[model samples]
Target: MIEFVLNGRPQKLDQVDPNLSILEWLRTKMRLTGTKEGCASGDCGACTVIIGTPDQSGKFQHEAVNSCISLIGSLHGKQLITIEAFRQEPGHPVQQTMMEQHGAQCGFCTPGIVMSLVALHASGQPDASSERAILEALSGNLCRCTGYRPIVAAGREALVQAWSPDDETHPAACLVQEKRALEATLSTGVGLSLPDGPRYDAPQTLDELRKLRGRFPEARLIAGGTDLALEITQQLKTLEHMISVERIPELSGCRVEGDELVIGAATTYRRFHRPISDRWPAFDGMLSRLGSLQIRNRGTVGGNIGNASPIGDMPPPLIALGATLVLDGPDGERRLPLEAFFLGYRKTDLQPGEFIHSVRVPMAQPGQRLFIYKVSKRLDDDISAVLGAFQLTLDGNEVVACRLAFGGMAATPARALAAETALCGQPWTEASVARAIAALASDFQPLSDVRASAGYRLQVAGNLLRRALLASDPRHNDEPMLVTDYA
Candidate 1:
């Protein structure tokens, strides 16, 4: 049985298909059809919903998530709020402000927009007035009919003026309290056994997960399912036997150990963003635009590396930052440099049954400067065409040392050794920058894929290094270059 709190009610599902999507379950089984299915594959923002879960402090936190591709099994122990609940409630700030701002045109994406706004408002972060904050909050939601101006206005209004004195008595809040009372209702103490002969195991400890992996080496291991679930929705594949390590308490925590950050493999970007970005400000900026709030809410940095996508944004920065990955299996734990984890296209150094347990990153030391550039067709919530990460240390006017890594340039996210060699020990000047840029040709022979051409990738890699050099120049505090504004 799958149990969760749905709009102040304890909802349970018996004999449910383990592969059924959350969107399908909500629209078909529950007969609550307010959530639209604009895109079946997690894009288009038509199927966004709010998920409330207990934070580390045991406080309930609301997050907007894409339900179209999210599996029903993923919502097993959380509070789910839909547009229907908001509609029934009298003058919820999101609904009232959306109406006052005239934020709905065709009304197809309005529910998702309102729900995403509600999540942002409920996040305890101050109502976002900044354009970037609003954009980051609504990045997952797309409205073709209602231009973003009104939607952003509504979001501001919801934050600024939408709350009522009676809101404490609202259904959602009552549901929160109810969910707290029913916290032990989750059947997590035992491994889940489906009636259809498929099983989904949720392990709460590293030893339990290790034993499970040792037992079922063939079982598909899942953390966030942000990428693995795509195999089901896009390629039409069924993950029969699965082990989910998301519930493991240790694997979902991040901490500062000495000068390095030890982040659990299952730690979401949202949880590690502040500590990580605090160490690397440029990295922080790239993360804000990495994906929509929904994607960031669940997407894990360790998962991104484990997925081994050449175009993933996280790997490039991790590689450039001299990060290491910890992999554990029946053979016990082994550590490897981040770059060595990727061997070829879609291939990794991970042995059978070995899964990534955690990632360790050395914090930025003094005189060390970092720059990350993500070149995507869209400014936010899009895949990267060319991503670059550079970590440099300068000695007066000389380039004492540097590390340059580029994604979407080769079969794997590899460092530009030739470029790094050319820049090291050279004077930090335009001449040295030009030489380093020229050496980029020898570093990579990129492919002409849909995202970018070989020549385009080569050129962008060099251009990104040039921008890094310019941005690192402390002689002037000039603004960094914007790829969108490039003529």
Candidate 2:
């Protein structure tokens, strides 16, 4: 049976459709209509909900996630909170501010917005009141009828208010006890079999996961389910047998091992933010723009790499950083460069029984300059039209070594060996940058898509390289090169 806490109450289910999403279960089974579904594909955040999971300190850490694309099976040992949890009588801060600031009109998207703000408040982050922080928190929720002005105002007001989590009556406080109980049950491991011939298994250790993989070779491996869930929600495909790697201790966190950052395959982007930003400061802005806060909270780096999409945002930067992947299977473990994992469009080198174990990124060295630029249609929660990641190691003015990787410029996220060779021994100047720009034409011949034309993709790719060169040069230190730095 699958167990979880819903609205401060413990819930257990012995039979359920493994393909059912949290949104679907809420509205269909529980008849909780407060969580509305807009775009079932997770683009629109009308189905946003808060999920509370225990952190290392045994305190509940709340995060907002897109419910429509989140499978019900994934809520095994966590707290699933919906908009119905808040009451109108004892009004919550988010609801009160929404009414005081006139944040709702037609009220179709108010619940999701309120849930997002609630998550922001529950985080207790020091910068929750800042306009940028509030905007980042609400980036996933879209208000079509009422503009964002009043909603942003409500967010600003609600965040500044004092919230006491210690209150015995508060949901957060109540969930603490319930979460502990739920975790205790989860310690035995979870294996659910539905009447409809679908099974979901969550293994706690690497040995259990390896055995499960061997036993069910055709079973799909899931971690975070940000991309995998789309098979059910968007394409209407049901996953019969699934093995979850998220619960495995060996595949759920990151650590610094010597000169490399060793990140587990199931590590979510939210967990990866600090370590990646600490190592490469330039990645902060680009990583935030990769997806909405909701997506980042649930999306895993390994899933992004394994998906093998030509325009996947993380691959270009990871490739440029010279990252390596560790894969495990019946034959034991093997290591290979990240770039070599992608075989073709939507294809990877993973064998039938092999799975990505972890990724190792080398630490940045002195005199190494790195630039990551993502050109997308929208500033937030959008796919890239062209993402350019450049890393250069310079000996004085001349470039000793460099790596230029671009996504959305080819069939796979690949390096521009031709362009890198052009700047290997050249001076790090406008002249050398121009030469590399010219060589990029020979490196890639992109296709025309709805996001951008092939010519525009090529043009932007070169311009991004030039922007990196200008931003890296000491002569242009005072100039604003990044979009966030402009204002």
Candidate 3:
């Protein structure tokens, strides 16, 4: 049995097929079709919906989630708010603002855009940085018809006219309480059955997850469905057994441990965004552009490392930061350095029955600089051409140590060993940067693909390294050295 709240109402699913995506379940099962499915894959944000979960502090935090690729079973014990549930009457404050600002056209994408705004409003980050914040929040949603001027205006207006605490509110609070009670009543602590041969299980504890996996060794351990959902929707493959790690409290927190930041395997990218972006401001911009906001809310760092995709975005930075991964298996737990974890393309040192439990990133020392860059065709909703990450420790006038890692330039997101070797002990100068660029070819033979030609990738990867060097130099002007104006 699986229980959750849908649009301010208690909901239950017993014989519902677990393999069905929330988008499918909403349209077919529940007859709630406000959430559109533009791209069955995770790219388009037409299926965006607001999901409210209890944070570590036990407060309800709402974030926009992609419903098309999201598994229905994953919605257990959470509050799901759809566009239809937002206002009691025809016009909510947000809806009225969008109307007043003329933000809607090709209304299919409006629901998603509105939900993203709802999430931003609920986040309580304030509107001091409203335009950039709204742009970043709505970046996942695409509105080809509208040039985004009115939508941005609407977002700003909504922020300006947001309701105070004393204003009359919707009845979602009562519904939330009632739904929580319903979930408690249906607490069987087991898996849900789906159509076809596949079975879906969500375990709340490590022992329970281990036992479930032990019973079904072929079962796939799913953290974020970002990658695995493609197996179902695109490939049309049915999983016999899937165990979601989202409910495991032990595997879902980011905490600090003596000079290291330990991130749980099940922690979503959204959960890590603030703290991580705060430490590395460049990452703040990258995090917003990582994918659609839906992907970040649903995807996890563990899923990225566990999948071991050559073009995976996070691995290069984590490897450059000297991170380590902890794996939990039936035998016990073991730790391995991130650099040593990847064995080959689509391969890792992870053994059968061994799952990634957490990743530990060592804190950087004083004067150490970390730079990450991703080159792609478009800034939003595109795969990387060549992604590079570098960590440099400067000894006054000399380079003490340098770690360089790149994705899409090799079979795996591995360190550019030869390039790092060239940069170490050399002065941080243009001559040293050129030597590192020349050594890139020795480290990896990049392939030509739809994203980029072989020569272009090599050139961009080299340029990224040089950009890192320039960005780190104190003598360089902090003012915008590079600027472009668009009509």
Candidate 4:
């Protein structure tokens, strides 16, 4: 049986569909219709909910996630707080301000918006009230009638007068105690299996995961289920058997090992953000635009790489950084470069019964410079049309070494070998940049797709190279170069 705390009460389920989503269970089975579903594909935030997991101190750390795409089986040993939880003796501060500021009209999106704000307020982060922070927090939520002006105002005010779980009598405190008890009762490697339906297995240790993978070679491996869930929700594909690697301690978290940043394969993007941005400051804007805050809370870097989509955003940057992966299987572990992992469109080099264990990124040297750019239709919560990542190390004004990688420009996220060769040993100037831009024609012949035409993709790729050159030039030292700088 799977156990969790729902609305400060313990909930246990022994027989449930493994492919069921949290949103479906809440609105259908539990008859809690407060959480509405607008875009079942996880684009619209009408199904937003707060997931609270106990931190080291036994206090809950809350994060907003999309209930529509998150599997119900993934909620084991955690607290699921839906919109119904806010209907207490005293309403939440966000609800009060939202009412006072007229932040709802038609009220279809209000529940999700309020839940997002509640998670932000409950976080107690110092910058949660800032204008940029508030806007980012609500990026996933779409309000057609009420507009964002009043909703933003409500968020700002609510943050100033927000209430936190401070004492023992608080409802959150009781939920925390209940969560601790539930976690203690959960056995390691707890999973859900239905005789007539699908099967979900969660392994807690590396050995357990390896053994499961060897036993069930046909089972799909899942982490955050951000991408895999779409098959079930959108395409109506039934994943009969699945193994979850998120609970494996050896496959989660990040650490600095000597001169490299070693990150577990199951580490969520939200957890890897700080460490990566700290090492390569150019990644801050691109990483934030990878998806909305809700997606990042549940999406993992390993999943992004494993998907092997030609236009996947993370691979381009990671390839330019010369990152490597550690894959674990029945025969033990093997290491491979990130670029070599992809063989073709939607194809990877992963063997049967093998899974990505971790990723290692080398630290930048003193004179090394990195530039990353994402070109998309929308600035936020959109897929990339072209993502360019360039890394260069110069000896004075001459380029000693360089790596140029582009996505959405080829069958796979591959390096522009022809362009990199043109830039190597050349002076860092507009003239040399033009040569590299010309070489791009030889490097890639991107295909036309719904996101962009082939000509547009090629043009954007060249322009991005020029932008990188300008960013590294001394003449443009005072100019704002990065997307985050303008924001």
CA lDDT, every model vs. true structure: 0.80, 0.86, 0.79, 0.87
In candidate 4, which residue ranges exceed 4 Å CA deviation?
162-164, 167-179, 475-487
Relative to the unseen true structure, what is the C-alpha lDDT of residue 165 in candidate 3, on a scale of 0 to 100? Answer: 31
Off by over 4 Å in 3: 56-58, 87-90, 164-188, 475-487
What lDDT is obtained when candidate 4 is compared to the true structure?
0.87
Per-residue accuracy of model 1 over 1-487 as CA lDDT, tens digit each: 5677787677777656666778888999888888998867666778888887766566677888888777777766778888887666574677887888988899988888888877777666654655667778888888887578988887786776434324676534532544455467553543455676767777667888888888888888776677887887788887888788787787887898999999999988898988888888877778877777788888887679888999988998889899999999889999999999999998999887899989999998878888888888777688888899988898887889898999999989999999999999998888998999999999999999787878888988888887876776677553432454222
lDDT of 2 at 17: 73
Question: Per-residue error at 402 for model 3, in Å?
Answer: 1.1
What would the TM-score be for candidate 1 when compared with the true structure?
0.95
lDDT of prediction 3: 0.79
Question: Would you estimate the TM-scores of all the predictions?
Answer: 0.95, 0.96, 0.93, 0.96
For every candidate structure, what is the RMSD over all alpha carbons to the true structure, in angstroms?
2.2, 2.3, 2.8, 2.3
For 369-400, candidate 3 gives per-residue lDDT tens digits of 78888777777766778888888898886788
lDDT of 4 by residue, 324-386 (tens): 989999999999999999999999999999999999998999889889898887777888888
Between candidates 2 and 3, name the one with more favorable lDDT.
2
Q: Write the per-residue lDDT of candidate 2 for residues 94-145, one digit (tens) a residue.
A: 8988999999998998999999998898888999988999999989888888
The superposed Cα distance between candidate 4 and the true structure at residue 21, in angstroms, equals 0.4
